[model samples]
Target chain A: MTERPDQSPLTSPRSERVRKAAALTGRSARRKQGRFRVEGPQAVRSLLTHRADLALEVFLTVRARADHPELASLAAEAGAPLREVDEQILRAMVRDSGDGGGDQGGADASPGAAVGGALVSPQGAIALATFSAEDPAAALGAVRALPADGPVTVVVLHEVRDPGNVGTMIRTADAAGADLVLLTRTSADPYSPKAVRASVGSLFHLPVLTGAEIDALLPALAAADVTAAATSGYADSDLFDTALPARLAWILGNEAHGLDEATLAAAPLTVRIPLAGHAESLNVHTAATVCLFETLRRRRLEA
Target chain B: MTERPDQSPLTSPRSERVRKAAALTGRSARRKQGRFRVEGPQAVRSLLTHRADLALEVFLTVRARADHPELASLAAEAGAPLREVDEQILRAMVRDSGDGGGDQGGADASPGAAVGGALVSPQGAIALATFSAEDPAAALGAVRALPADGPVTVVVLHEVRDPGNVGTMIRTADAAGADLVLLTRTSADPYSPKAVRASVGSLFHLPVLTGAEIDALLPALAAADVTAAATSGYADSDLFDTALPARLAWILGNEAHGLDEATLAAAPLTVRIPLAGHAESLNVHTAATVCLFETLRRRRLEA
Candidate 1:
């Protein structure tokens, strides 16, 4: 096992630029720089493997190096520059690089104490990599681009703001072999740390298209002969009873508010997860998993 | 709508004693007082409906009163004394109520801001009520008490400490119409605010038996002729292919570690949720939901 050396001199202009670019916290800044920070060993490893075509910059804390020796080798395999810092500094870096907020300084000052009990340490390691920005038009084209041999399944999330739920849905959609995961305007950024963490690196593998105009997407879905299946708490049609189409776009909405009237109008079919218990509804993520897996099961049965 | 008058004046020596008893914030204290704080409107409503027989006292902030006018009527219908305090004081009360730490003076200092976002504000209201104390003996009896007609499903959570997940499981178990929800010694308190909130009041509807000695409960489970179905991420048997018994105890483990070897050994059946995607594992809550609902579907089909 090649041990990661601490403090590689931060010399190259590109390396400096990538590091500075990774530090950009604002969503707009990240988009402008064409770079984003991926954290945790599993996520970083996944990004390195599946997204090897993209330019990657890796950073590891001393603790992370001790815990994951293979990470250094993996970075080398990808021909990426690697650097190590103290756990405190790494934590400060994560805090600085976090979504802009009032608690940035306080979080950095406190360091690992905040997330001390969790498995992935706040101060562990992170990777700065260029994510191929999938153009919405291109992503839509890619949906159209799928082979005509089977039905295509696209996931459309409307105002589902919780990143964890969104991320889990995308991961579940991928697991179920869905074609695309689309996010509406009000949805949390698919790349947000929480969403990425929940997705368990599936984000890198899946085609995630965001900021989609629902009006345009709906018509395109229709033109592609894809039916929109809207999930609702009050829908009369039971989810298990619905005749699932091969090419379907499953539409899920906010936890508090179901699909808006316009979205519902666009959806040709609506289904409900039958609830017998006292709970009014399932957690959005859990519901999504249930629906996606059901679709997967149906497809398998057909095959 | 009948307005409940300021209740500080109605405080009796008995009320003070009950308040002091609940102030301890321990299992013993909750058991001794036969009362525990149910934070937030949803929990309060749940308790009000299902556990109304144990109604004792209700407290609320003026703001809480405004937000939930039905609370006043519910309290009145239950014949529980209702009290109102400054919003700041209510916020402090709830904040202090948890873990029994925090300055009460600070609670009353910023009344409106204090209660604004918290699950429960001190000014919002506290209720003194009775809960049926868990008697492992009684739970065992209930296991024995299952009717001979239909299959009985019991949910056993082993060391699953996330309060929210535990709560959600309890709710899901109830939703699936499971017979009981059991917790190992290490699992979260089913009555904790977060768990209660996540359950959305299913906690009261479900028969929750916690803090069991696994050594004692294992044999009882065996005696009930309930097949133990342990969930694993990498078990040999696919969950969809498994023959789910009519009488089954589904064992779920902690978020990080799945079922322990001993627990797995105790299980006659082990099932895995197939992950076709790259993600390492499903969220514990999502996994539990999938398993529980699968069992429900299987049982229904068999019926």
Candidate 2:
């Protein structure tokens, strides 16, 4: 295993090219170029442990290598090139600041700036990995083919457009032990850097299938005996009162517009989260978390 | 009510001055200059409806005035001056396109570019109102002094740091019927533009008290029969399993460090959101939602 390289400055033009390339790490770009960026020592280590089959490129700063010896050793053990760069360059490479650079009452820099600095602080560490895009049919087939002991819960995001929401949904679905996550065409890119950061590394662990047409998904879900439940603002039945199915697929919708007519028609039941206060609707991501957890809670009680 | 002026295209140097002034609308700046920026038609309408006792100013786009007759009438009713500008000029003034450009996403224009051929789609808008610096203690005291119809639930953000999270928390607190939101010195500004956007107009409706030094808050919470519950990874108690208090103050920490030791020590009970999957932790906003709703659920059951 080789020692992790020091990545303190953006001196190399090659490193700058790599950093610029990471901007296209969104799902659309990933589909075109077949690459994604992963950062932090823990994420890199996890990639080395599980996705060694995927081509890996490493960028690190001296501080990160020194702070995380295991990460350096793991990269060396996997025969991955660990290149070093300046912190400023690493900071520039990360796309969104997560916080949108809003003021924090002068207590500290905006959250986005803070998060960016934190990510850059470990010196600088990032990795590029190739992810095999799975066919929706093949993914559905694999879910159907799981053994009896496999996870039965499935999550469906229909027309959910926020990348942060998509990422959080995947993260929550993973936490709820859902077997699969499927996203429709109009949904946000699951692999977008924003979504990935929001997921807090859960994206790598979760089984995510994206870009599936809804018409094709309906039959596959039906074949698997997965009951579809859609969330609505006007539904009479509250989510807590519903009889959650043992094998279920939860369909979440867009922020402004809930589910479209087609998906609502496909769903066997529509559930609403009871709103007691004056706010009209929950944030899309919060709604997803609540829905996913409610399902997990129900299943646990039933078991 | 007279017709409101359209200020979409900010060609005039006077319009440029207004836009720049609005950008500096923080608590301190607002106090110093007695100005604040109000965006969107709905928010502007609400400000008028409230007839809040404060000096008001109006900046509107021609397209916005034509689209919303009521907005024009309302500005006239308030006797506020309205300025009209071309769509491009308005866009430029808003800095939507570039640093000083008004175009939002999808525009390649530099900041402060001329509005030569820009498309104008101003619906209806106005920036009105100058707010005096509110005394945080007085605002908080007023909220606390109100007669309790039911148990009080206060949200105390220790170092939330994220403007979006802070804004979302305030919105959620409003939705969940929390009595008040108390932000410590390290928390995000409650009135920042991004925060206001994320709150979805709840900022005006919810009572927010900011800059509460943590040391002073602990004693006040105790005296008010409020139990401070700290959320942390090290805590052995599950949040759902804990015996929640009738009057509670939820203290959430920064994304990384969580609640500091002093804050944790001050908290009467420490609770954790149990994670059975691969996620390291829930997003701070998501965690806040879970904690808030859990409290709501418990309170409802007891009632």
Candidate 3:
């Protein structure tokens, strides 16, 4: 596993590549470089397992290398350049200074960035990978591939800015057998480290088409006869009684501002998950989960 | 709302109240003081609404007080002192450094703490309140109070240590119409600021009994005719096919170790949530949400 000729420990915390890697925290940098990072062992390993071709490189600490021999070999097979760095550099690569205010609040969400008011500490390895620079048309093609008689589900995020929420929704979509996830241009970046980790690697498992507007995607949905439904608290349509078509998309909004009128107007049906609890609503991912799993349950019974 | 005599901008971040509020980030301090903090406007509002008598004081920024006049009024009506603090003090009361490592990982997840690797910046007000120190026997008493054929559900968290997960589980249980939530002795403190915030005010709505053991609760569960079902990935019983009774309890394990063998064996049945995704298992809260909602779905279908 330690067969690499450049086996010397990378001690400099300010290496150019490491700095570039750290820059992936910003949306502009990730967009400019077409790359995002995967932090921690589980996420990095998943990248190798599912999307090895896109994995550009792997960085590990000495202790991590010793602890995870198989990960090293797996990265080797993926042809990702594996380098060992000082643990301090690895932490620096992902750490964010906690004192944040104003515009900077939403920029990074990289691994170990303060999220949901908890420090998600760094684990083992880290990986840098190239992400699709533009929306993947192939994601729509996958949606079209759904059988006429078979049940198909798609989860849509409309201005849902929390990266963790975005990731968890994707993971939930995968578990519920959704064909893909759609994130509007204003939603959290799906490739951000926090979002990727929150998805628990489901970002790689499922087709995630980001930076697309509902208006632009409407034509593709029309062609495929996919029914787009927006989830709204104000909607009169209850989830339990709503008619879910064979090919359907469930769209949720931001933690605060919810779905914009344009997005809600685009969908013929606006449905609400009937939450009996006193809390105003379910967490975005939980609401998506309820919708996704309900679709699955109904499909199973119908089948 | 401006009726409090001590209304002043708390500038010194090291003041006694600010220090005490900061100490709430630790479980020991919360336990010893019999006080826990609620951060963000949603959580603080809910505390005022549901547990107003328990609320001892509220600290808010000038802007927060101006924006949430109703909350200030509620606090005033509850006889809870309202104090204005500089935004910095408010931030300090809940902000986590986001640089964390080792065993201290789960200790502090207060509002604006680094969570899932990103600092979730705080939204608004903070509240300090005393929680019932002892496990509420009335929670179990409520389960016993259920009508002979009425649906009664209890959510059991077995050593789930993440404050976020603990809070999310409580919220899920409430949303799924569970009678109450029980935390095993080893579980995270339900009253921690992070857990309370994650609950999004559902914490105030539900009865959460902490410092409990499954062994002692099993007998009561049995006597109440509540079926104890542990969620296990290896369990042969599929969640869909499992026998969910009118009265039941769903137990979920820790994020890392999962359920200990002793706890698993004590449960009359073990059921697994079916996952079609490539991911190995569901997140603790997502798993709990799935189980709780599925039970709700089935009961509704039967009715």
Candidate with the greatest DockQ versus the true structure: 3
lDDT string, candidate 1, A1-303, tens digits: 122323555444245443453354345555666666677788888777777555367778777888988888888888878887555555554544444422111221122212111324533677776654535576567557666667677888888865656777887877767777888777766765546666777887767788776777787788888888887777888877788998888888875576788898779988888776677677666677778877876777787
| Model 1 ranges with Cα > 4 A deviation | A1-33, A96-123, A132-139, B1-34, B61-69, B96-135
Write one digit per residue (lDDT tens) for candidate 1, span B1-303: 112323445334234443453353345555555566665676676677777766676767677889889888888888887777554434443332444222111221222212111223333555656665656676677667766557888888888865657777888888777878888777866654445556767888867887765666778878878777887866899887778888888888887787788988878888888766566677677787778888777776787
Scored against the true structure, residue A269 in model 2 reaches a CA lDDT of 78
Q: Could you tell which candidate, 2 or 3, scores higher by lDDT? A: 3
Candidate 1 backbone overlaps, count: 12
lDDT of 3 at A135: 64
Query: Which whole-number lDDT from 0 to 100 does residue B201 have in model 1?
Result: 76
In angstroms, give how far residue A119 of model 3 lies from its true place: 6.4
State the fraction of real interface contacts model 2 keeps. 0.33
Cα lDDT of model 3 by residue, A119-153, tens digit:
66556588888887546365566557656555678
- What would the per-residue lDDT of candidate 2 be over residues A1-303, giving only the tens digit for each residue? 112333454575346454444444444456666766676676676677656555366777778778877777777778776777666556555543223222111111121222311222323677777765646666566557644453478888877866667777788877767777888777777665556555666777766777677777877777777787888887888777778878788888877678788888888878887666667788777787777777766666667
| Candidate 3 lDDT score at position B33 | 72
What DockQ score does model 2 reach against the true complex? 0.25
How accurate locally, in lDDT, is each candidate? 0.67, 0.64, 0.75
Estimate TM-scores for all models.
0.83, 0.82, 0.85
Q: In terms of docking quality, how is candidate 2 classified? A: acceptable
Mind giving the per-residue lDDT tens digits that candidate 3 earns over B4-104? 23455578877765766677777667777778788878888888998887788888888998988898899988899888878888878775433221113
